[model samples]
Target: MLQRLKLLEHINPGAAHRNVADSIPPPQLHKMSLPYNKVLVLGATSGIGLAYAEKIVEDGKKAIVVGRRKENLDAFVEKHGKDKAEAITFDITQVGTIPNFVEDITKRHPDLDCVLLNSGIQRGFDFAQPETVDLDVLDLELTTNYIAHVHLTQAFLPHLQKQSKQTALVYTSSGLALVPSVKRLNYCASKAALHHFLLCLREQMKDGPGNVKVIEIFPPAVQTELHDEKHQPDIKNGRQMGMPLDEFTAESWAKLVQGDDQIAVGMADRLFALFENTRQQQFQKMVEMMKGH
Candidate 1:
C-alpha cells in the first residue's frame, strides 16, 4: 500500500514540476530580424531618449527623433545629418493632437516599425508639506509621465500592429517601480503604473502573430538635467548618482541590439536581482525605508 501511495503521489496534479513545463512559453525563434530599417524615438531632446536616438543613427538605422523643442530637434538633425536622422517637434502632453501627429508620421515614413516612448519628468515632493508640493506641478508630472505615454501607445498601436514583422513598443520606466524612493511619490507612482501596464500588454500579445514586442528599460539615477542645477552640491554630497550620459547610452545601445526585453542599467540591475531573489522581504524593506524619508 505504501509503494502504491508513492506512485500516486508522482502522478498527482499537485506534483511540483508537473505544471512548470507547461507554464513555459516557447522561446522566440526569429531574433535577428530588425523590426524596421527606420524607428521613431519620442523625447529626443535630452537624457536617455536622445542618447538612444544617437546610438540608433550611429548603428546606421534611420531614426526620427521627436521633442517639444524645435531648436533642439533642428540641431540634432544637423549634427546627425538628414540621411540617417530626422527631428520633429511634438508635445506628448497634447493628447488631442496625438492622433493627427501619428498619422502624419506614418504617412511620411510608412516603413517605420519601432516606437520608443521615452519622455518623462521627475520631481521631488513633500506630501507632508503643502507649500513644497504644488498641485499643478504634480498634475503635470503625472500627465506627462503616464497619461501621455498611454495615449501615444494607443495612437500608434494600429500602425504597429499592422506591420509585417519585428514591430516593437519600447518604454523607459524606472527602478523606482521595484523599490520606492522618498520624496518622489509622483514619479514612483507613475513609473510603477507604467511597468504594470507594459507587463499586461506583453501577456496579452503572447499568442498573437508576434507582431508587437514590448520592451521595458529600467534605469537608475543618471546624470541628467532632471535635477536642479542649484541642488547639484546637495546631490553630490548625498550619494553617487547615475553614470555619465555617454556611458549609459553605450551600455543601453548594446543591450537593445541584442534584443533584451528588460534592460536594467548600473545599480538598477542589482535591484532587479534582489526582487527576483527575495520579493516579499525586499518589498517590505523598501516600504520601511520610504516611510522614514
Candidate 2:
C-alpha cells in the first residue's frame, strides 16, 4: 500500500480527505440541485456510462442512455422503468449522424441540458509489429474515444447554451490520459486528447453566465467491460490495482453533486499531475519496473 501511495502521492496529496461519506446526497436532496439532473449518457449500455446512469436514477433524476445495441437498450429501458430512464440506440462513433440525432433529441426532450461523453474504446497496440498491426484499429480507438465525443458535444452545445436552466458537459477520461500505459498507446492518446478538448470547452464556455458547466471525471482502473477477452489477463492483473466499481461510482456521483469541476476518483489524481512534474520520469521508471515484475 505504501508503495502504491509513493508512486501517486505527488498528485494525490489530499488522499486523506477521501472518506467524506457524510457528503453523500440525502434521500430528499436537501442540498444543491445537481446540474446534470436530466442528462444524456453516451455509450450508456455498459461499463461506467451505465453505472453513471443508474446512479442518476437512484438519485431520483432522469438519464437518457445512448448505446449501439437496440437489444441492450431495450432490456435496460424495460428494467429501469421508462419514466426514470430512457434509451437512445445509436452508435456514438457514427459522428456524422450525431447532428441529426441531436436535433431529434432536442425536439423530443427540450429539457435535456447535460451530455456526459462516456462512450469509449480501450485497445492495445504494438509499435514494433507495424506490419502485423491493423492501422484501422487506431482509427477506431481515436474516433470512438475522442473524436465522436467532440462531434456530439458540438452538436449539443449550441442547444444547451440556449437553455435557461443550468447545463453540464461531462467527460470520462481515463487515468492513462495523464500517465500513459505502455500497451494501449492509442487509447491513452485518445483520452489525452479528450482531456485537452474538455479543458478548451470549459474555457470557451466560461463567460456563458454559468449556465453551462464542464466537468471531467478522471477514472483510474475499475472493473468495467471496456476491454475484450484477449485483454483479460491484463485486466485481471490491473483489477486489484483499482477501487471497486461501486465505490468509484458512488464517490464520483457524490463529488459531482458537491460541485467538483474536475473530479478524480480515488488515486486517479495522484497520476494526473505526472506530466507536469518531474515525477513523470519517476512514473515511467516505475512502469518499466512493473513490466519487469
Candidate 3:
C-alpha cells in the first residue's frame, strides 16, 4: 500500500518524475472534441475511469457517473455539484438491462453526446490447475469486458445518429488485446474480440450517414487499482514497470481532446508495431503461396 502511494506521488500533477512516452496518434487522425458537456462514463468510480472523471471535472464539464456501488456514486455527486455530476446505478454485467438503461440515459439527458465504455476486468488463469478454473469468474470477465459494451453501443447508436451534435462512442480496449498474454487468457481474448467488433461496427457507421464517431483507446499498463491490486499480470512495460496514473491520464486526455479516433499510450506502441509487422509478413507469405497455386 505504501509503495503504491509513493509511486503515485512520483507523478502527481506537478511532480518531476513523469514518464512521458512517444505514443503518437495515427498520422491521419484529428484531435477529439473534448470537455464533454454531458458524457456518460461507465465504471466512473475506479482506476482509469476515475482519473478520466477527474479530468472532466477539471475541464468544468458535466458527466453522468455510472457505477455499481450506490455509496460511491452518491459521494461523487455530493462532492461535485449534483447538477454537474449526476449518478446512475448500473451493473453492466447485467446485460439484459442494458437496452432499458440506454433508453433511460437518452431520455433523461438529451444533451449527452458521448458514451465512454471503460468498464472491464482482468482475471488470471493457470492451465495446469484446470480444476481450479472458476466458470463464474470467466463468465463475468467475458460479459463485462466485451459483450456488455456491444449491447449498450447497439442500443445507443441509433439515437446518436438522430442527434444534431457530433456524438462519440468510446471503448477502452487493452494493449494486451493486440499482444497476447498467457496470464489472463480470457481477458485478452475478450478485448481482442471487442477490438475487432469495434472495427466492424465503425465500418457500418461509415457506410451510412451517421453523426456518431467511433473511438478506440488502447491503454498500456497504467497504474490502477484494478491492475495493481486485482489481477496483476506480467504485462510487459517498456521504460518503466507501469505508467504512473497521472502521466497516463494526462497523456490520454490530451489525445482525446485533440480529436483522435484511436489512441495508444506508453508501451502500447510496441504491441501495435509488432502486430502490424507480423500481419504484413503473413499477408506477403500468403500472396507468395497463392502465386504457386
Candidate 4:
C-alpha cells in the first residue's frame, strides 16, 4: 500500500489534492431532444459507419459522410441522393489536417448539429511471438481508432458548443472495450482508452457551456469489414462474424432516438452492465474523495 501511494505521488505530485468537480448530469438533463438533423459521420465509406449514414438518410435527416476513398464517397452520394447526403473525402489519420478540415466543414454546413466518430482499424498481435508483430500496423491501428477521434473531437467541439439547440458528439466503441479480447491487443487497448476518455469528456462537458451531449455506442463484434481476412488469416469469413449489420443498426438507432447516452446492444449490453455495476460506484466514490481533499 505504501509502495502504491509512493508510485501515485511520483506519477503526479499534485493529483491527490486537486479540486475535482462533480461530472454527473441529472437524469432529466440526459433526456434532451434529438434535434440532430445534420450529422457528420466519419469513416462512412463502409461497414457500421455506412450503415449509420444510410439509416440517417432513411429517417429524412441529412448525413455528411466522410471517408478516405473518393470512389466510395461518390457512390454513397449517388445512391442516397445529394439532397439527403453529402460526401467528403478525408483521411482521419492525417491528424495535422483535422482542424482545417473541421473548420471548412463547419463553415460550409453551419447547421451541422452532430458528429459521429466511427473510424477504426483492428489487427491481431501475439506478444509471445514478438517477431510477428508489426509496429507500424500497431501504431496505425491506435492512431485510426483512438488518437484521431480525440483530435476530431477537439476540432469540432467549439462549433458544437456554439449551437443554440442540442448537439452531440457520438462515438462507436466496442464491447471489447469493457471485456478485452486477448489476441487483438492494440485494438482492445485503444477501445479501452477511448472508453475512459469518453468518461472524462462527459465530466468536463457537464461543467461547461452549451448542450453538447456526448453519446457512446458499444457494439458486439458486428458483421463488418473491420477484420481483414487476407492479412489475419486465422479469422476466416470475417464479414460473416458476430451480429448482423441490420439487426445491430436497428437496435442501436432505436436507443439513440430514445436519448440513451450510452447505447450497448446484445452482448455489449451485458458486458456494459457487468462492468458499470462494479466500477461506476467505486469511480463516484473516488471522485467524491478527491473533491473533499
In order, the Cα lDDT scores of the candidates are: 0.81, 0.80, 0.80, 0.89
Displacement of the residue 99 alpha carbon in candidate 3, Å? 1.3
> Which candidate number would show the highest lDDT if scored against the true structure?
4
Candidate 4 lDDT over residue span 153-225, tens digit each: 9999999998888899999999888888889989999999999999878877886688889999999999988
- lDDT at position 40, candidate 3: 88
Model 2 ranges with Cα > 4 A deviation: 1-33, 230-241, 272-293
- Which residue ranges in model 4 land beyond 4 Å of their true spot? 1-34
lDDT of 1 by residue, 1-293 (tens): 76665786778834543666787999988634334578899998988888888777876788899999889889989998999989899998888999999999999998889999999887777878788768888888898889999998888888878887878899999888777788788889999899878876776666565488899988888777765444333344333356877887777766777889888888778987866336646655765676546
| Clash list (residue pairs), candidate 4 | none
Rank candidates by lDDT, best first.
4, 1, 2, 3
Clash count for candidate 2 is 0
- In model 3, the worst 10-residue window by lDDT is 230-239
Clash pairs, candidate 2, are none
Clashes of each: 0, 0, 6, 0
- TM-score, candidate number 4: 0.86
